[model samples]
Target: MTQLAIDVPENIFSTLRLPPAEFAREMRIAAAVQWYAEQRVSQEKAAEIAGQSRIEFIDELRRRRIPAIQLDLDELEAELNDG
Candidate 1:
């Protein structure tokens, strides 16, 4: 695993009420979620990046009100018409 170091303001930890380790974890999860939402990464890849299991990542998506399936209206319509 590659390790990354970021410089954050000291006060940010207190402001967010998160310690450095927890804050790093949250940052990872947030970045993974954003990438997943943007269609830049698959759910499996995003889960791996977030250090979460697939099921846990799906639950996180649900909690954040993000759709797990990335189907658009055209795809939905086509499926409906095919059925």
Candidate 2:
């Protein structure tokens, strides 16, 4: 595993009520979620990047109100028509 170090303002911890370690974890999850939402990565890859299991990642997506499936209107319509 690769480790990354970033500099954050000291007050950010107090402001967010999160310790450094927790902040780092949250940052990773947030980045993974954003990438997943943007369709830049698959759910499995995002989950790996977030250091979470697939089910946990799905729960995270639910918490963030992001759709787990990426189907658009056209896809939905096609599926409905096919059925």
Candidate 3:
């Protein structure tokens, strides 16, 4: 378990329905996933950073319609060939 400090605007806080402590945890997970996406991190690694199991993270990615893999056409072709 980890602890963090956070503050939120009243309107946003109510809108998110976030309790103070849980808010920080959720925010950390959200930020971690976003940062990982911005940095182009691998799914497995991103899941770790988000503090969620890979299966859960992958499911969330699918639910969010975020691409699981960001591969160039050449890389995709090579991967397909290898497979």
Estimate the Cα RMSD of every predicted model relative to the unseen true structure.
Answer: 1.5, 1.6, 2.5
Q: How does each model score on lDDT?
A: 0.96, 0.97, 0.74
Model 1, CA-based lDDT: 0.96
TM-score-best of 1 and 2: 1
Itemize residue pairs with steric clashes in candidate 1. Answer: none
TM-score for each of the candidates: 0.89, 0.88, 0.71
The per-residue C-alpha lDDT of model 1 at residue 45 equals: 100
Estimate, for each residue in 59-79, the C-alpha lDDT of model 1 and write its tens digit. 999999999999899999999
Ranking by TM-score: 1, 2, 3
Which whole-number lDDT from 0 to 100 does residue 60 have in model 1? 93
Tell me, by TM-score, which candidate is best: 1
**Ten contiguous residues minimizing lDDT sum, candidate 3:** 1-10
Which one wins by lDDT: 1 or 3?
Answer: 1
Candidates sorted by lDDT, best first: 2, 1, 3
Q: Give candidate 2's total backbone clashes.
A: 0
